[model samples]
Target: MATTRKQHSEQSAPGPVAAFARFVGCGGGVGVASSFAVAGLASWIPWALANALVTAVSTLLATELHARFTFGAGRHATWRQHVQSAGSAAAAYAVTCLAMVVLQQLVATPGAVLEQVVYLSASALTGIARFAVLRLVVFARSRTQATAPAPAVRPVRAAAPAGPAELCPAA
Candidate 1:
């Protein structure tokens, strides 16, 4: 199918606040879903392993959404973007893990709701940081290049029939 210019620029480089909002929407949505996935996976495997698996998958999914919607890349994330996003995700994973460990130490028998609160709070904070990195580093070039103004093109003028010499000789 053909894409119209309107469709192409539909996500045309949102401002910082708008982009962050979209970033949270995309990341938060994936985060919530991944939390559930982790919980399910933990039943069969170690919690750390489950979280790692979920993080990897969710990072890719979130990166794609952020590229197309949040950052106005208007396309799929590049391999480099995905790798960089994964790095951010790794940091986020560490933060969430650290938060859970802290929660565990504080409460001998923390409830599921309490654990979720800590986890999601940590996720949310790291998500903000991730948005900055993705915007400034991972997808900066794509945004600038896409929205960059096209270069001007001057019309080529034909030779003026050798100017005065041609005019006099021909005359």
Candidate 2:
């Protein structure tokens, strides 16, 4: 009964498209803010390491946002969700890093503007993918339970007697 009620609540939360919009809004805000931090840190350290640090912090923040606002989980993310989301974030980190590496290979001296453009572009691409994975994988359990039908309740039929109810009549 409790599970059914919980599932019913989750069923009323945002569907995929709405959740995607929320995901982009919340997660993108965090990503953009972290990018600035990453840029600053990169000036002081290696770009890859800076991005990695920012990615970890931003992943935790975004996971909480995704749990509370994006998917309407209405609570803080569990450690499991955080870890799963971190996996997605790691992939996103690899994307942005690879994009930067490619840009460096292509341009002998990319300006700050070019770097930001490439970085944000790669982030946007990966954001879409991250949304899908988060929606269908990380945050999918509630939605799945919500949408799934309740188990059928069939009446228990009484077994018929083997031929002669006359010989074995009920007392």
What is candidate 1's local distance difference test score?
Answer: 0.88
Error of 2 at 26 (Å): 0.4
Q: Give TM-scores for every candidate, taking all chains together and pairing residue i with residue i.
A: 0.84, 0.81
- After superposing candidate 2 on the true structure, give the runs of residues whose Cα lies further than 4 Å from its correct spot: 1-11, 146-171
- Candidate 2 structure quality by residue, lDDT tens digits, 30-139: 98898899999999999999999999999999999998778867667888889999999999999999999999999999998899999999999999999999998998
Who wins the TM-score comparison?
1
- Model 1 Cα displacement at 16 (Å)? 0.9
**Model 1 weakest 10-residue run by lDDT:** 3-12
Model 1 segments more than 4 A misplaced: 1-7, 153-171
Native-referenced Cα lDDT, model 2 = 0.88
